[model samples]
Target: MSELDALRERVVALERENDELRTPKRRRIRGRSVIGAVLLVLAVVLAPVAAMGTWARLQLVETESFVATFAPLASDPDVQDFVAEQVSAAIDEQVDVSAVVGEVFDGIRSLGLPPRADTALTLLEGPAADGAISLIDGVVHDVVRSEQFADIWTQSLRFTHDRATAILQNAPGTAVQLSDDGAVTIELGVVIERVKQAMSERGIGLADVIPEIDRSIPIAQADSLALVRTVYQVADIGGFWLPWLVVALVVAGVLLMRDRPRAVLWSSAAIALVFLLLSAGLGIGRGVFLRAVSPEIMSAAAATALFEQLTSLLAGTIAAIALIGVLAAMWAWLAGSSRAAAGFRGLVDSGFSAVRGAAERRGLTTGAFGRGIDRFRGPIFIAAVVVVTVLLIASRPVSFGSVIGAGVGLLVVAVLVELLRRPSEPKEMDVDPSADAATSTAQDPVSAPDAVS
Candidate 1:
């Protein structure tokens, strides 16, 4: 068993033993442990969810993360496509390419080449329409994908988030305006004007036809404020402390159990359940949010995108926590006293020992340094495993490449650490057969002193 696992098992046993000694079973309140376990279950269930909510709020409410959060959307194909459609529709209103086509047809008909010329021109309308829409699509694409668009996107997000935060605090903000009916809005007038100017600069010739485009999209409505207020209150009071409290409660609950490893497994299972619950809650909350707002207030795509972006990191974190719990439980199970667990451990030890033997035979394991490696092998191995797991989980987003890389790196470290262990030399027998026989004769003389012998 690992030092940590052993220590925990001992602690759990000692704590329970101490409690029992202090109070007789008959004198103790009925079902006290059951009630305590129930509370612990609740803690395991709620803590992770509360932590995820806190993260979502921090990301949404903070200025830097808020801007960074939506910056990538400017580059998203769908988002760019949406922007292009809206801009193209607004610009198409003023350009009237069909009018230009009509004028050309009138001029061509005046040539008097054929009576069916107008009908022929009408046949060209589909191609002309395609060409016009395609041209608008190209111009909009370039504008939306530009660095200028990125800056605008960042600024707009910051303004909107700031406005939302202000409204939450009842403070002043310009970009975030509210209707008399309490519909929240972030005006996109500047963004539309910029796109028009960009299209003109790109020599699309439709700049003159691009009418003034200014618009406001609703982000939230008045009725959702009650829900917002609840979250705001959590951010105000719980903040980062909620996660810590969760840890304390979970630890206390685990210690109350006489089998800490089993408790760990149970807690982990409960945490997974919480993850499922939180995911369901997010879906339900999205519906609630939508129902509370006017459908015309915002684009469905935009609303979904906002909710997704806000929850992405939180979801990833929850997944990581669940993964950690599963790994921890598995590790604890490996240390069980069951026959299968023992066999598995023995196999692992034998594999390690074989590797060590090969290294020693190759002269890689020798001297005081090798001895030092043997002394701290367990701790060093644990530290390396922890470092690798944490780096994969916390430092960067995990990908296939990253997982393979981390696995290879950990294997190399383990091999290198094992290579530094000095193999033990077999001890010679303390007494030869001849010496034992001589010692027996001496013992006969000594036995005479003990009369009964």
Candidate 2:
């Protein structure tokens, strides 16, 4: 073979070897990219689901949480009005006041009253019934608005919390009953009994005849209760595990990326976006719930109050999570290599240096303590972040206030770290003999050394 052909073959072999070396690396890169993408997408998609599941688990599975959540609804004016209206209507339905008054007029007519008197009695009947109804309504309102009623409301919810859970789980129960049309109503037997006793004390003669009846008020309703029950069941199971799963996926996804800080930044932003979308979905679901429940079943105000009160925990949870995501993204960006991040770090460092210089000029240096802090500032900062994050997550039903407090606390810690860090003093420079002699010669040219040729 010719030398040119041999050289060509050698070059071809080197090129083939280079291609073989690049192929595995390219495949590995592509595989890592695909895995990271899948994990991130899963985390983003399931974040809202995890949040909702946590809410449902807390509100349904934990009786105490459920009671704590709904107990406050007793003080809501809208809810009070709704209860009073339902109880009064229930009483009115049981005892027809107009009919009773008509019967009395009929008895009077049998005693040969004048024709004008009969017409007057007939004209007065409706107003008398209306006046009676107004009186009942007034009593009912007073009962519902009183502190005693609030206590009863709380106690009743606590007592029936288990039953409510059972109902959500599709278990048979009589304490908290579900109507055939998907209306979940609680029997206000205690409230009704109280109302009757109050009326009797007020000398309402009809109160003596008003029989003890089970008057149920619909609190929640849907077109398809079966779907709600199914969702609750699924949420009950997922609530226990989905949140952990989502967190694992997010961590895995971030760790898999070569640029972990940037991955974390994007992941946090995506999670926050998901939370915002979840919030919007809640608003839309509220509208849909209100529309689905007919006016005959529940008033708009009452329904709105119920929905808001019940979902308040969920809303707060979402807000706290979103805040955490935003804070994480902010931290990731601040720690990044971008120009903005570098500029911010520079500005902070300059400020710290200025403060330290001022303090040193005044002879108020941190001394050994500052040096120690400076030596371990990185660990201190990391510990602070970890503590704040753990506290935020460990809080039961995390609130916006808690999240904000944590963020503020972290900021304060960072500021303290910067303030406490003192740079070491610069040492004196050592001069080289040759350079020193050259400088001396340059300063005094007449004393320069002779050149050896």
- By summed lDDT, the worst window of 10 consecutive residues in model 1 runs over 444-453
Report the C-alpha lDDT of model 2 over 1-453, residue by residue, as the tens digit. Answer: 964454455556666887888787543466776698789889989988888888888876888898888889899998899888888888887888777777777898888888999898889878988888788789899999999889888887776666656777767545656544666555688898888888888998767766787877656556776776776678778887787788778878976787777888998999898898889998999999889764766788988988899999999999988988899899999989999999999998998999989988999888899999999998898798767755655565678999899889989998988887887878889999977854554444333333100
Tens-place lDDT per residue, model 1, 1-453, is 864454455556666778889887664543645665875787886666566656755654667766776677777766666666666666666567767656666787778766576677778766876786677678777887788877887787787777667766667545554344555554556667886687677776655666676666554555666567566667755655565566666667766765666776777677766766776787888877656542453456755666677567666666655555555566557766668888998997789888877766877656888878878887887688667766754443333455456657766876777666775667886788865754454444444234222
Query: Among all windows of ten consecutive residues in candidate 2, which has the lowest summed lDDT?
Result: 444-453
Superposed Cα deviation of residue 403, candidate 1 (Å) = 9.3
* Number of residue pairs clashing in candidate 1, backbone atoms closer than 3 angstroms, sequence gap of 3 or more or interchain: 0
Query: Which candidate has the top score in lDDT?
Result: 2
Q: Give the Cα lDDT of each candidate.
A: 0.65, 0.80
TM-score, candidate number 1: 0.61
lDDT score of residue 183 within candidate 2: 61
Q: Which whole-number lDDT from 0 to 100 does residue 385 have in model 2?
A: 74
Best by TM-score: 2
Question: Could you give the C-alpha RMSD of every candidate to the true structure, in order shown?
Answer: 10.7, 8.8
lDDT at position 143, candidate 1: 80
Itemize residue pairs with steric clashes in candidate 1.
Answer: none
